[model samples]
Target: MRRVPDVRPPALRPAAVLPGPAPRRGPVTVALAGAEFGWGSSGKLSAVLSALRERARLPLRFVGLASGLGRPLLAEHSVEHWYDLPDAAADRRAAVGRIVRSHGVRAAVVVLDGAIATALQAAGVPTVFVDSLPFLWTEGDRAALPLDATVYCAQQCVGLPPECEGILASVASLRWVEAVIGTPPAGSTGTPGTPGTRTWRKALVSLGGLGAPRLPDRTAYPRVVVPAVLDALAEHGVQEAHLAGNLPAGLLGGLVERPPAGLRVTAGPLPHSAFLSELTRCDVLLASPGLTTLLEAGRLGVPTVCLPPQNLSQIFNGRFHSRAVGVDVRVVWPENVFREEEALGLRAKGEDHALELIYGGIGRVAARADGTPGAAGLRAAVLAAVRRAAGGADWGALTAAVGTGGAAQVAEALLAIAGPTPARGA
Candidate 1:
């Protein structure tokens, strides 16, 4: 008997051996945000989002909130919608609640934006909070953070000074991670320098933390640091360089005003990948010591000189860089400007008190463009540090000390909590 093969396309592709929760009916939407103060938070979010894209089980859509200075930074990523941070503090909760509900956000990933993270959690969305500056927090900042987040990923630092004691431990679901940085593409690694013979062909100077809201004048750091770095790069035989950051519009002309003979200097902000690409190709990197940039450059084996810290975290970052490299690869603010010890000491009082000294000192130095002793001292230090980096010493220790697998670790945590709730479809 010709039993017409009982084929209904093999029972419509045989039923699942075990029934699963109907395989997420639609793309899962996730909320993303970074602290508005600087690019550090956004950079961290970029790395994590990149990692999540790789690891996510279902198709994903991203919506952003309150990523102010960072909104443009994530331009190339896949964020489908963006909402400015609520203009009024009073509206924060309601605004965020509306966003979560409207977007159908199954989960959220917030980098250092505690207020938003807390708000999303209150709206009944699980959140994975990345705290890149766990060591920068104190009692004063406790109220701003959601320590009991579903997953609190605190970047493990070189040391968790006495001042930051318990800040990390207090997180209800704290997970310590290595540097959460994105992997650069192939051929981005730096060349190993020869002590006497190497000539830096290209130097990339990255200045982050430039748009910190509290500082009305964004030019202070760049005004003092740019020319000094350009000159130093020229002295070290660098033929060309690029300065990347959120520099003020009119500042570009001044940054390139006086490049050393035969040295071509260009200055402007770069997208995250673009900046990292430049970092990997350059012979040396001079940057405002933001941890994310330092970690990115370090992973590429790029010779990095911490251009004196721009804010609280940077001070510690510069010190950590030096401690890890076992060399002071930092160009510091002159002691007359403000001692690192003194600023750090003030943290016991509160970050604002410390920031007062830092901001005022930088402002004072920036005002001293006439080559006053303090300003000249700063210029000399930057020159010396970049010069040292050009000599081809091992500067990868900092990255090695703080491993670079953090982005994946963070992604894993986020995915775990991102599971659909009983109320929502799986």
Candidate 2:
């Protein structure tokens, strides 16, 4: 049986002595970058990677192991081959190393931290872990996650979790792609809307891509939660309600079947742009806490009624968003919201009432994922740093954060940074 390297290393004792400065590479070379992008989730991630790659001139060869969920969006950017390897992490690392050598790749970029990332790092590959997505980096001992260097969305989001103070990369995600990407559909100005100023008549309920790939409603969290919202809306006399998400209609058939007469539920897949646009149109958003949707809704100035799922990661996301910014809160008993099926059933009808209370207290806590001044500023820095290190002509500072990644620039950056490393125990 094949074994995967324990990427999350065991606890280490504290030390004071510092090692002498090790040899520094003349430049950075990126061989490949992997992100599990698909239609519903990680679409922004792949796009961000592409843009970063282009700016850095790193050549990227994507390995579409899981499925072509993000293939359509990827196809639009560049027609790269969909490479796949064995499922095991060790095997993946081996395969990736082979590909890197064959393609003459030096370092690899893993868009988000996960099995693939850990595996690549285990293979002794020079890696850059990009904390672009909201991966509760707030809690983990990031140093344990294998990587030569790290980049995060913002310094606020990085650092050692409370339990351990380990070495983490100076790279901040927010700083990495600010100027290179586009902003959310909502304008970037003032503090993000809080729950106090805006009054929402009804709370929109969804679990986000309910029937889709990353998150499925096998346990029917949506079924339990949406019905509660429907009941709440009816009681408040909020006749018209919009249900936006990808929850399967069949799973939610019962809730919709008797949906209190006048409420309108529109459920299907909407691209990220359209999704943000719809958020602007809606007043209240009641849903599970997913990074993309939650962040966008917050950015759009929409009050969020978050029902965090059972997963520790989900709970962390909900708690962080709530505490970090002021939003309404429903303290579901037992840390795990997924376990509270009974609560879901009882509160399903009262969700709208909760939303109303939440709307009454407008709060501000969110940043635009793209094109905001903050985001744009970060992108320009990365581009400038890469060009200076590469000795490339100073392309003036990047002003706007474009939504798409530029692969050609990535290719150039990677080659500039890459150099020969001796095989194990040279």
Candidate 3:
């Protein structure tokens, strides 16, 4: 029998130095806690942590949860330590307490994991919650999660409750992109298309790390959507298309193996720098309503078309971003995916009291997939959006709205909350 290889990343340790004059103050450490659903959360966390470590200018130690998807990325980013938190509440609390005490952790940055956030707060560790979706806090009795600060990302997050303190910003992964791929010129729109020339447009199809999750089978939607998208792009004079996401190799291979005649489709996960480079060159980005990918595309001024979202939060994000930037953004979702009666039931239960839910319901109505329109209808919608995007997108307004220097701003906040570094006195 063949043995399965271990996919878990190895434990990380802090770098050691030769003996020298001991400083008066011990090292200051900060812990980051979040469950890695996909590359999005971990990518942002790594970028912020890297920025904080460099800018803080103190002896800093890093601790993070050893989530499978995030561990490798954290290791790649050189985080000092990774811990496996227990599932049980008491055990989780004890584990967090031990980490804080052992590492001398003064503060923590949590990415939308309420259990960890609550545990850290109970342990007397100052905690900052990095939230991407307004409704994520509504899950599993975590609505009352206490946070010292909350960092909201993208246009969808505007007007979220300002708990303790809030900093509105663009996708955090842009920091990583800027660090790796170099920043694009300010106010520069995407590459100009040759007018009246039937040139082949370059399109990128990235449906994000997990694809749509609310479906009965999360992976099924992409199989149907991708082929149809490729067909649409081919029909509309797109010759070279790349499909990049955190999809399994087998799934990606199936999609790329048989491309429409004269259309070359290459599918795989590209490194961060390479992915950003492709985004710069592509005329349009056909993607799922992932906040990271959407914000990145908006920041780069690439026109975008989002597949119907599997969940309510994504619905809100897609519509808000499309309207905010005047970009040719289209959100396509199957009509039957969400039932109106169920929605009414949720509203009746007072769940839609939050503005996020109310706005999301509006988005769902506007962007319904309506498969009765068939592949031809979907193709036309995609083609039209692409044509508009190829003309020019509102890169300047989108970038300005999202703001720059987000990494620096967040790092400064973290350092301030951490208080003065212990003095290295005589």
Candidate 4:
């Protein structure tokens, strides 16, 4: 059994130290937070951190706000402080204000966690907000966002649907940016996927961040999606594959009676760097289509296929990938299960309403597998989608469509927001 990494930082006890007056000058403090939904926010946060470090004129002090689900992903970065955000709106604002005052936080970099960004600004801290899913937003989500953020960096997409317009227009200073994905290795001229037929030997199936707090049974996605994905990969001659994400325990042994193609499959969560390493080694990526992973794989020129999306943002991501590459690589539920567009239509009611349809459909399929109704048709749908991606795909087109300079772009914006004080804080 391959050991799954427990990447959360170890808690330390405060030790008494010789009392020395706090230094008058040091690194400028920057508070970071990603939406607790998944690893995408943390990935974007890490990329921006790297960019800030690379481009900083003065030393930087990094802290975290609401590192709940994203803590494992953020463990790799230098976030000296981590504070769990409160649930109540009033408490959340009070906690953020305390963090800002205590750390002397001058500016903040927030990805998707709109509430925290709004709170930071309430505390008089300038926030550079990253809205990666502008295409998925609606009027219902307006209150969560810091509409008057100092700098709201909305990622560029193929299209901003009607649902997003009102919320996007609400932002005070919205600046468009390229995909905020991790940078590729320097001087590496690796070709996309496998050469010739693109028959993949090693595969990576990413279920994305599965610990969605909304989900009662997070296993519903992996239990149903994994078997279908493994079947497809095996049929395509893949010999080895790694299933990456925060997944349920004993899911493989329980769900998959037989591992396809005599294939070796390892399931577990990976830190950002390790996940990128797996991307480089694999010939093809079959994933739940989180925007960050798609954009990163695009930068790496990796052949990619979209598994059924688990959320509103993912639906847009899968569609965006298909449009950019001119390939219908996304696997979606059957109409009998739930029409994708219909589910999307519920965005006005809130992301939860849209996700209810998606999750309910997936739950039905999973229940069917347990002899409730039947999951054969749903599994077959996924199988077909994976096979279609194998035919041939221009995966790099996504990268070309959205340049990979977003990290640097966000970093520059933060510096500008930080202004003369922090720039000269040293």
Cα lDDT computed for each candidate against the true fold? 0.77, 0.41, 0.57, 0.78
Summarize candidate 3's per-residue lDDT along 28-82 as a digit string, tens digits: 6788865545556665575576566656545677788645554544554556788
Candidate 1 lDDT for residue 392: 67
Q: Output the number of the TM-score-best candidate.
A: 1
Off by over 4 Å in 3: 1-26, 71-75, 135-144, 147-200, 209-216, 339-374, 420-426
Which of 2 and 3 is the better model by TM-score? 3
Q: Model 1 over residues 268-293: C-alpha lDDT tens digits?
A: 78888888777767777888888998
Error of 1 at 29 (Å): 1.0
| Pairs with steric clashes in candidate 4 | none
Give me the runs in candidate 2 sitting further than 4 Å from their true place.
Answer: 1-79, 98-108, 119-126, 132-144, 149-155, 158-161, 167-182, 186-191, 194-217, 237-258, 331-426
Q: Model 2, 1-426: lDDT tens per residue?
A: 122122321111111111234234232334334344223234444444555443432234443333344444344344344556676666877886676565444556554434555665565555544443333332233443443443222212211242222223333322232211223453632134422223345555555433332332233444444555565555444556666554455655655666766666555545445555566666556566654455555445455555534233344455555544432343332322124334223232332233222222111101223212232332333223222222211111111111122222222223333434334333
Residue by residue across 43-157, what tens digits does model 4's lDDT show?
A: 8998888888777666788989985777887677788889887899999999999989899898999998888988999999999999988777788878777889998998877
Question: Candidate 2 has what TM-score?
Answer: 0.55
Name the 10 consecutive residues with the lowest summed lDDT in model 4. Answer: 9-18
Q: Judge candidate 3 against the unseen true structure and give its global Cα lDDT, from 0 to 1.
A: 0.57
A best-first ranking of the candidates according to their lDDT comes to: 4, 1, 3, 2
